[model samples]
Target: MDLQQLPGYLTMALPLLAYAAFLVVMHVGQRRLGALAALKVPLHLAALGLLLRVGAANLPTPWPARLLPYSEALIIFAGVVLIIRAVDAIGVGYLLARLQKRHVPHILRQGAILLADFIAALIVLRQYLNLDVTSLVATSAVVSFVVGLASQDLLGSVLAGLVIGVERPIAHGNWVNVNGMEGRVVDVTWRRTRIETRDGDFILLPNNVVMKDTVTNYTLPSPLHRVRVEVGAHYRHPPNQVKAAMIAAARQCPEVLAEPAPSVFLESFGDSSINYRLNAWTMDYGRQEAIRDEVNCLIWYQFQREGIEIPFPIRTLVAPPPEPSAHEQRQDQIERIVPLLLDSEVFQGVSAPDLLAVADRMNLLTFGAGEMLFNEGDHGDSLYLLAQGRAQVIKRTPEGGQALLATLEEGQCLGEMALLLGLPRTASVRLERDSRVVEIKADLFRELIRAHPSFLDHLSRLVDQRQRANQELAQALAQQKTADAAGGIGQILRKIKSALGL
Candidate 1:
């Protein structure tokens, strides 16, 4: 018991430090060589730590002459067990995963694993030190009771966490609207869970708060999603026709799945509008917003083609403004033409006079959200210049379903890809908000190109830049795919580190 009587504490601490250094080296070596290659590294470190401690005890010193052997042996054995138990915990993770069918959930499994490790550590401490856990337990109970009174909220939260882990009402990767926090679930930690909101804000909600609040999970067992596109056509338009057109709009949008297909529900009958809801299914939360844009855009075009007027959201107030002067009218036409010319990536090198002349021939049209500019595989000779609204280019899987791949915002132009390549429509596109656009019909577009030889070179350069950007995106996606295929987060991180020269 008189450990102080030992010749030097230096004798004990120095060797222990060497063993610690060795453990670090072992860990680093294992990680570098391969993450899974060092399964026994921790156990090896544990053994080395115990051996060093045992050797230090046996040094020529007046350390606890009677208890030295017993204490050293017991401590070393306990160290070994502690390390083994840590390995056991890893095994425990795999066993539970199999038993739970990966459905028992991660948060609960982590808690159970931590509790088990705590019990194992406690047992080693109690048996080796001849400590009376029962006596300690009694004292702790008294102290805990007093502490509990003062920490009711803390205890409540802890209990709430336990309840949440058991119930698992919310899960990882769920697109949940929690307490007005709308986003994807990034992680569920022990004390708190985090959500990455749609606007890219991270929210940490305590388990207790989460347990008590309202929550919605869009993707639980699977990632299938439904998008709601509210549409209002002219009241004069037959409600059933409007509904049929809306459904047709969504179905034509290659991104909208057909099995769930696109359904229309009569939501309301408004003063100036009869609302038809177009509900379409998607497989991804990230792409839902864009998909809705594509679907709504199609509906608008469909309605217009059918002579169904899409109403403007006006208060029906104020008298009409006086007619514009000829000068003002000409200026307005030029204003429309300037944007249409600028949006022509094909006209960048064209002479200013030629550009203006070509612009004069382009028709400027306004678009509202839920308006379809084009559908996948649609034949089109004209190109579009997105003057002001947001649009989404919808990509369909080879399996014959739609997915929104990209969002095209203001100043972004499309259909040029098809025009330049002379191929079928690569993807469908739609507007996201009420906005305006300019269209150059197919013949007019080619007429400008023939009139302006400078235009072709500009288009080629623009095409090259776009393709380069696409190449970079493709490379990034490939890297991500490789990482995902490698394994979990730790492995993914390692792969990124290796690939990126980190």
Candidate 2:
């Protein structure tokens, strides 16, 4: 190799080597860092080009004068490209990181690179092209004004986009209400923002309009959003019961958050029913409709099972009154009670005639669903046979909530302990639906026990078995074991004998 031409050869060889290294770096960066890699490509190119220009300038045998300018221009062009790319990459990376909860410093780094590029470009232009950019700009005021006027809206949008990008007022995945349209932000660009609406349609809102319009970013401070649903139920059910049902329904929805917890409010009393609202928090606005639907569906089923009536609008028509007879009403009541008495195990041994006679004496009481028949610890002198519909036995818990102990359907009995030992009611019993119950008074039982001495044994045995069954139910629920359930039979017998003076 000729030693004198070594600088020229090295200039060429160094650029080729630099180009090869740049390719390797780009490959590695693209594989690992994606777009961030493109940022360094121009830098490598600029460095190699500068090296080539300087090496050629100092060569003992310099390149031809005509080729000198071209070579230097290429170096400056490479530097300019690197500067522009650095600004764009840094700015975009910062914006994306801010949107995604990733962190990057954008303004300082991007501005510095941009300023450095501008100075370098000025130097390159002055040194090579013999041009003054400042004087050129000063002479083009009319052209600048015309361009600005023509792209006013475009400029405004770009400025707005810059503001949003820097301030981070809205981000990707944010649930927002823009003007009257509600949607999730899909992407934000220089001139427009893309929003995916609840209807699954994408809407493009101009950046300027997005900045000017009223914006409600639901996920700004937090993603958990509170939503409320209004509903009406019949006035028969108590407020506490209604509230419990609504909250339970809200909690059933998987999208609902448990930390904040669900709540119910009594809004108002309507003409025919009570109005209520259920409030719950959910993070997914995308599935908000489904969440509400699931909650409402659960509420409907719960209301049905709890016998909570949801009233509907009804229109009335005038009609003439027909015949009314007290005898027919009394006969209906007797018939209603007869079957109930025959179905009860307490009257199992009694003949049909005797049962019918007893049914005639028994009082037929009616109760609407959700009506409390008797409360815990309330003095009761009668046991009830549910003749139609069902009833729920609810025991009050220490937490001020009600725990359901048992469900009594048609032919089932409740408050039996009241008549058996003449004790206070142990738990509250509420009608689960419109129902008629046969009330067998303590006096009636005393009279029947006195007439048939042998019947006392059967009655005592029945009472004892029922007490044991109740204890077992309590045990199954993981409750405290029942107290003193034994000897219920003897106690009932003694109480009946003493009351009847037998």
Model 1 per-residue lDDT tens digits across residues 300-335: 789879999877766587688899996677668777
Q: After superposition, how far is residue 267 of candidate 1 from its true place, in Å?
A: 4.6
Give the clashing pairs for model 2.
Answer: none
- Using TM-score, give the best candidate's number: 1
Candidate 2: tens digits of C-alpha lDDT, residues 1-502: 7898876677667766767787787778779987755556466656666656655665555464645775676677676777677655555555555556665333334455666665776777778977887896576777878988999988788778777878878888898999999999998877788999978899999889999999999988878888788889998787878988999888888889997999998999887789999998888767778888888899999899899998885644649587558767777888777766777788877767766666667888878678998999898778888888899999988899989999988898888766665666779999887787778877677667656667778876776676567763334323422345444455656765654455
Q: How close is every model to the real structure, measured as TM-score?
A: 0.50, 0.49
In model 2, what lDDT does residue 417 have?
65
Clashes of 1: 9
User: Which 10 residues in a row give candidate 2 its minimum summed lDDT?
Assistant: 473-482
Highest-scoring model, lDDT: 2
Overlapping backbone residue pairs in candidate 2 total: 0
